[model samples]
Target: MRQAMYGLVLYVFLMLPPVANLAESVMTIHMHMQMPLFVIAGMLMTPFLKQQFPRFFAKWNSNGVPGIILFMIVVIYWMIPRTMDEALTIQAIEIFKFISLPFLAGVPLRDSWKKIRLVGKNIIFVTLSVICGFMAWLYIFSPEQLCNNYLIVEQITLGWAFLFLALSIMIYFVQQFFVDRSECE
Candidate 1:
């Protein structure tokens, strides 16, 4: 209950014009920071939502794969450069962005993460890393600006950000192979 209230507060705060404007002013902040924050707010409220609609989650996501896949699809959709532009230009798309990122992507992600096996989790992580790597290459190497709203320099910065994220994921994967769970525990 308390967590849900906190999430609601975050949701409301992020919706504020000043905050939203500042976040959206920067390309990287809009995509990487603000978007993720919305999803996180939803994740924080998952406990209450899960308790309220137990059957919906269970019936639709018995093994967690379905929910996670939905999460990935929603997230990937938002990652598209054109979608970001549409969200800024079109009011309906903006509203959908605010609503969909939280409910569509975040809720299922939190629900599915706990239920999915470790191998499943690893696969998702690796897939995201690969996607990030691809996006980085696309943004960095493209001669033209990818987003109309942002300059080429900002686009390059976002590409570097994606590169760092991909590299970090790869580093984590490498570390996992060397770490002995028995020793740590």
Candidate 2:
């Protein structure tokens, strides 16, 4: 299970740069279609994940640590002014959806040796991939149209995405060091 998760993470990271470049070249309509397909793929994987990783689910059921942290971050950000501005707020919401990918993907591996480490690593890589993809898209397409009336939401969302990615990377490295030290001791 750990190997599989690690493989998936590597695969996603490797594929992202090319995918982003391809997305930049493709017609806007085609890109739009592809984005939702990725979402569908995630949704479809849920059942298989549950069947394969019952132990992880058990861990998730026993602990609310991840969810609680996510909630607190959201709430704290909400309290800050300008965060609620339309564009940034929408971006923040979009970022939340992106971050969900790791939690959902990692939920099935909670009790395994990799445990949260696997999740953290995968999340960090995936988030970085996404940010890179977006940067590519923004640079190439430069779509002037705002999906929402407020542009602040998009800024907030980007900020949140970076924060999540950084936090995940930090946790992953810290856990890895501890695990390595424990084994040595």
Best by lDDT: 1
Best by TM-score: 1
- Candidate 2 per-residue lDDT over residues 82-183, each given as its tens digit: 333331346555355334433343332232223345465556455545544553444334445323333444434544444554466556656665576657
lDDT of 1 at 39: 97
Worst ten-residue run, lDDT, model 2? 27-36
Report the C-alpha displacement of residue 137, candidate 2, in angstroms.
Answer: 8.9
> Residue 141, candidate 2: how far off, in angstroms?
11
Question: Model 1, which residues run further than 4 Å from truth?
Answer: 181-185
Residues 36-106 of candidate 1 have per-residue lDDT tens digits of: 99999989889999999999989999899998999999999998999989988998999999999988888
